[model samples]
Target: MDQFTLNLLVVGATFALYFGIAIWARAGTTSEFYTAGGGVHPVLNGMATGADWMSAASFISMAGIIAAGGYDTSAYLMGWTGGYVLLAMLLAPYLRKFGKFTVPEFIGDRFYSQSARLVAVICLIVASVTYVIGQMTGVGVAFSRFLEVKASTGLYIGAAVVFFYAVLGGMKGITYTQVAQYVVLIFAYTIPAVFISLQLTGNALPPLGLFSTHIESGMPLLAKLDQVVQELGFAKYTGHSDTTLNMFLFTMSLMIGTAGLPHVIVRFFTVPKVADARASAGWALVFIALLYTVAPAVGAMARLNLISNIYPNGTQSDPIAYEARPDWMRNWETTGLLKFEDKNGDGLIEFYNDKSKNEDFNAAAAAKGWAGNELTVNNDIMVLANPEIARLPGWVVALVAAGGLAAALSTAAGLLLAISSAISHDLIKGSLNPNISEKGELMAARVSMGVAIAVATYLGLNPPGFAAQTVALAFGLAAASIFPALMMGIFSKRINNVGAVAGMLSGLLVTVVYIFLHKGWFFIPDTNSYTDAAPLLLSIKSTSFGAVGALVNFAVAFAVSRATAAPPQAIQDLVEGIRIPRGAGKAQSH
Candidate 1:
């Protein structure tokens, strides 16, 4: 079968499987609607959380960023995974013990203020909505590249599939579907990586292969990659070039953001007990680490593979013939992720950093009779193209396509669930209409889910920013606003309702304005006047500014809380109860 047909068959079948599961496991009660009935095994919850957390960023774009940016991009790996440790030690168990339907619900009841809950709801919706746009975009990109459809068409189809399962299954359906997604995504991700590792280094384990000697060059793989990329005027593969302070802050932002993300936090609520919540986090990290450890290896090896394909012999030798280039190159070229031009009237492709204004690199390229580097490749294409580059079987390639869809769709469903619950349980049920019936609230959740999907689809159709960049905003908002409020609610009895609300508003406004100034309003173009170089304040890039915003939140909250009366004794008791694991049970509608 043609690649497109095969991809369609594989991806279509996987969607069918998820839809079937959703139909079979449709939620019936409020408990099922919110926490999947709290019957989920720890391991299964761990796997589901892994699938939920990975999203399009982990599955589709992370390796590509690592491949292009080299060691400087290690912030993504460290930040995203390190956040789980924060979640486990500081947040998960307590939240589970509190046993809430939504993060905003916890904030509202804990703070004893309707406005505080409303603010939390707004933040939750904004973060989840922004995050889901990236996922829908990822699904579009994968489908367009593999299934031979326009990105818009792919997005529509993807949204339809997710809506089918998410609206039908609620948390119950999503949890089981995510377990299946984890299986598909991990298998698809690892198989091609293993093949490529063995092909380049004769090492079966990709992570070890990254540091081991390359079979072709008899040098350490990373060392060889460094040499080749440097010769092409790019930074060394394993050396840092960005400012250390910025990297540190960026990593910190991602870590805090990860812990604060509502969709991820809600997963802990589904586990049967507070102890299981902690254990589930450990298991989730184990599952996440499986992909995390292999990612750098994939990034390094894929970069090397790309360079080898372009140079054929070595950077010192003549470029590869255009006609003899692999099918993967021609295929990706069609997607505009990879491009080549026959500069200097040569029939060969020269792939290098043509924009290097450095004198030494320019002199070298000039002496080599090269006009300029003529290939432009998007970093997001690296992981998706890995299987094809390694000449893996058609089935493996199809499976990878399905896996990418699974990763994107699973995360989208999770985010939608969070968004829906925040609207229904926290906003409508808590304040807007306390008399809403269980069936009425369920209908409201479904309506919100459908609307959330529509908004995400529209944003995906006209992406305001890159996948990772947009996702970073979601993290920044979460880190600056919701995380501090929740943490202080548990850790400090002095933090009053007014204090929490003020702090969150300040943090949210600062972070949002900073991101908007750099990324533009709603990520639309012609909106940003300053780049990261001329940022709003210090040497901070918007991506790293979340930490600063978070600090501002803490300071404001502390100042305001000190000026106000302490919370009621009952509220204090609730905080203390949340800290301990005893008597934790299925969270109910308040």
Candidate 2:
């Protein structure tokens, strides 16, 4: 069968399965919609959480970022993995025991203020909407290439698919659908890695293959990769280029951000008991480790494969003529993601770092009469195009297409659910209309989700950065605003309503303003005063500012709380009750 037909068949089958699950597990009440009826098995919930957690950024864009940035980009892998651990241990079980329907709900009740809940709803929407934009971007990239549609058109179609299942089944459908998505995505991710690993290093397991010798070069795989990239003016594959401070803050942001994300935290609420929540988190870590470990191998192998294809001999030799470029290049070029322009008007395509500081490489390029880098490859395309770049089988490529879609759609559903629940549950029922009927609230949830999907699709067309970078910004916002509030609510009895509100607003405002100054106001193109290359702060990019925002939140909360009256005695007792290990299991029963 042709590649397009194979892609359609595989991707269509997965969509069909998602719809089937949605219908079979359709939610009937607010409880089912919000928390999947609170009866999902721990292992099953963990698998579903794995799918929910690994969005388009993780599946489609992370490896691409790693491939281009090398060691500096490992922060994405480290931060996300560590953040999941932090979320699972520091927050998940406690939140689940509290038995709130949403993050804002927990915050509102814990702080004993309706104003706190409303502020949390705002924070949840801001972070989740930003996150959905990244997922939609991935959907566009995957669809534009495989489905042979314009990126905007792909986003519209993806929105339609998400609307059907997400609006119909709510969390109940999303949870089960995500479990199936996990299976498809993991198989799709690991199979390509296995094939490429064997092809490059004669090792079947990708993690081991990463450290194994390159079959043809007889050198350690990373050592060979570093030599090749450095020869072409790129940084060493294992060398750090970003500052230690920025890396440290970036990692911390992602870690705490994971804990704060309403979509991820809500997953814990789907389990039957507090212990089940903990068990599910452990299982999720194991499942997440599967893809996270293979990602580095895939990135390294694909980078090598890509450069090897372009420089058939070596970087010093003449590159392949533009007309002689491989089929993969032609296919990706159609999507406008991989492009070649002959700046020197030479027939050959030169793919190298144009801004390299290497004098010897510059002199060599000057002697060769090279003008500048001619090939522009988008980082988001690296993983999606990896199987094709490596000349893998058509089926493997098709599987990847399905896997990428599954990853994007699964996370989009989760984020939209968080957004919708925040609106309908926290804002409408909890605040605006406390007497709202269950049926009315359910309709509001669906409508809110539909609106969120429309907004997400619109923003996806004009994303501020690549998928992973956009997602990182979302993480930063969550870390700054929501995480500090949740932590203080659960751990500290002195954090009154005024303090919680002050901290969330202060953290969110600072981070948003910092990002806008560098990334443009609301991410509009060419409207920014500064760029990440020369950030307003000292070596602190907007993406790294979340950790700083989080610190500001904690400081402000403490200062404000100490200057004001203490939390009510009942509130203090409530906080104490949630923290006590012995009574934690009984609280779930209450």
- Write out the backbone clash pairs for model 1: none
Q: Cα lDDT for residue 319, model 1?
A: 82
**Who wins the TM-score comparison?**
2
User: Candidate 1: global Cα-lDDT?
Assistant: 0.86
| Backbone clashes (count) for model 2 | 1
Model 2 deviation from the true structure expressed as Cα RMSD, one decimal place:
1.9
Give all candidates' CA lDDT scores. Answer: 0.86, 0.91
- What's the C-alpha lDDT at position 454 in model 1? 91
What's each prediction's TM-score? Answer: 0.95, 0.97
Model 1 collision count: 0
Stretches of candidate 1 off by over 4 Å are 321-324, 341-347, 366-373, 520-533
**Top lDDT: which candidate number?**
2
**Model 2: per-residue Cα lDDT at residue 573:** 93
Give the CA lDDT, 0 to 100, for residue 239 in model 1: 85
lDDT of 1 by residue, 1-590 (tens): 88878987888788878988999889998789889998899999999999999988898888888988888888999999999899888988888888888899889989999999999999888888988988998888787688565666778888888889999999999999999999999998998889999998899999998888999889988889989988888877788777888788888888898889999999988988888888899899999998999999999888888888778777555888888889988887666557788898878887877777568998888887888878777666788888887678888889888888898999999999999999999888888899999999999999999999999998887665556766876887888888899889888878989899999999988888887775545456542122343555655678888888899999999998889888899998888888887778887767
